[model samples]
Target: MEGCRNSKDYMMDVAGRVFVLGVGIDNVNLGEALKRIQEYVENGTAGLVVTANPEIVMLARKSPDFKAYLDNALMVTADGIGILIGARLLGRPIKQRVTGIDLTTALFEQAAAKKYKFYFVGAKPGVAEAAAENIRKAYPGIEIIGIQHGYFNDDSKIIDDIKIKKPDILLAALGMGKQEKWIEERVKPAGVPVSIGVGGSFDVFSGEAKRAPKWIQDAGIEWLYRLIRQPSRFWRMLQLPKFLGAIILSRLFSGK
Candidate 1:
């Protein structure tokens, strides 16, 4: 295990960060975030990257351990519309939304060009393989060093395997809190540089789910499109209002 005390100078020049729902999110654009991630990979710096949305933020609020774990991440991008709204309501403007899928794609582009090795974890039995196949078709030269399903009872073996593989990046798609926790507790210590929690991205890349159109994504209402597609998400969608309420409370109490 490389340990988590490694240098974080890669984040020194980050555009800026703002605390919303008590989690510090970087205000950089996607390009800047990708550049920082590349630095981590090239320099062999072990760290975790977080894609924080409303659901993940609420989970963090409910779990002190998770919140503290997030603080230790090398970067936490605003991945949800609620994060942008919360930042604006607090008078802090984030530059853009850096969704996990976008981030993964960006890294894939770089890996293809630079021949950086990648390891993917999470998703159903064959979903990761399917996603990797799709990525190979898209990025011809991208090297996928390893992959594993998320149904394991213990993570010790997976962590050891990642340490042995030493891929430049590890994308974990084990949902929200679980993915982040796995990255922090297992992947990061295994010396994998630029570990990211990409919830359900494999499903999309593997053709199990369809992403909303670019227009919808540009309009920043992909959440609505998702709810329309997966009506079962209706209950989870209720958290948006709760997130907003929490932001309002944060503003009132902090006087920011």
Candidate 2:
């Protein structure tokens, strides 16, 4: 709502349920968020995440439910440097970008420590298997109850599978807003304590797509690097200018 700068008022929306957080914040870092997420998982709780890409924040401004869902989310962190900049401009800057992918890795580590089981859901073809195998290799002894690719139509089907496994953590790599909506409607109400929408992170983690180097990520140029690496991103890149305009207009007119 308040230009995506308010972390205390975090959350974004979709058609299904309340997202616990929003973008355009820059206060929480991966370390702090890892702690918060650990607290939630250890206690059996749930939340949502929207990367603070300018386009998403801009979309949050235009979409009523998106803004409200984000506002109601339990945690929202700045996932992009642009959002950090926006928050600074608004004088309520968050401290760092909390990337969903990085958070997933941290969560896996924490789950390993706690012996928590995780469910890998969504993504096409070999992505899910690769991600699961990669995780198993990276973090030994963490239980992965089950794995399913993002190819189903009936949401109930996936819900049934997840209900059976009852993993402590569920990571949906269905990409962007769609992933949020899917989990909100199908996963959250089914009693999933913690479910997050990870956009294409599975691919990168699984080595399907090459992630940037450490320096590239630190420079906050990962996005640009991604766009350059993935030509398919050209269409997605088109969303930026539109999102940017929406943010400015929302600020000027007080769009909620």
Candidate 3:
């Protein structure tokens, strides 16, 4: 019960919140976001950290269940350039984009130095293992207590294992919706101090997928890079324009 902070109480501290299309995105930079997570770990508070992009925000707009999850999440950082643009249009500019991969990689550095335990669950078979191995190499002393592929039919075993291992942080890369839902419904309840939906971070870490270059990411065109790299994401990329359009419409109507 101590880990489960009430959603109302969490949202009451509105100093860093920017509402975009009815979803609250924290206006913290990457360092601030990491500091909050470190606080969670130190306080032994169970929390769901959502790295929400335009796609995820749009999905939350369309789905009540998803929207509820976002509303209740302990922290929702702006994970996409579209989110920052939308916040600006809404006259509530966010500080920066705190992406899942960047946050996770930063956390690894802290975990390595602080000796925090980790449990990684998601990505394709062998992918999480590969990422774990690479992580071990990169962060020599970091403790990864458990690893599991996301291809399971039932998550009971995985949940049980996580409960037992009780890692300080749990990273689930089961894509967007599923990963968030899993972290909220399963990992948080299992009492993990910090749980995050990492999307394809494992794939990136495993070298199965390459992230966009620094310039592309800084230019806020990483979406374009991703689309160019994986043409199959054309449909997903379409969400960007839709998200921007909605923001413009909202601003026009509300005179924000």
Candidate 2 lDDT, tens digit per residue, 69-112?
Answer: 56555566666666665555443546677788878888788776
TM-scores for every candidate against the unseen true structure? 0.91, 0.83, 0.94
Please write out the lDDT profile of model 3 over residues 58-92, one tens digit for every residue: 89877889988888888999999999887776667
Best by lDDT: 3
Record all residue pairs in model 3 with backbone atoms less than 3 Å apart, i.e. clashing.
none
What is the C-alpha lDDT profile of model 1 across 1-256, one tens digit per residue? 1111122211223447777766788988899999898888889889889988988878877788998878899999999988998878877778999999999888888887766899999999999999999999999889999989988998788888888888998889898788888788777777887889999899999999999999999999999999999999999999889888877766665544
lDDT of 3 at 236: 94
lDDT of 3: 0.86
Specify the poorest-scoring 10-residue window by lDDT in model 1. Answer: 1-10
**Which residue ranges in model 3 land beyond 4 Å of their true spot?**
1-13
Model 2 CA deviation exceeding 4 Å by range: 1-26, 241-256
| Model 2 backbone overlap count | 17
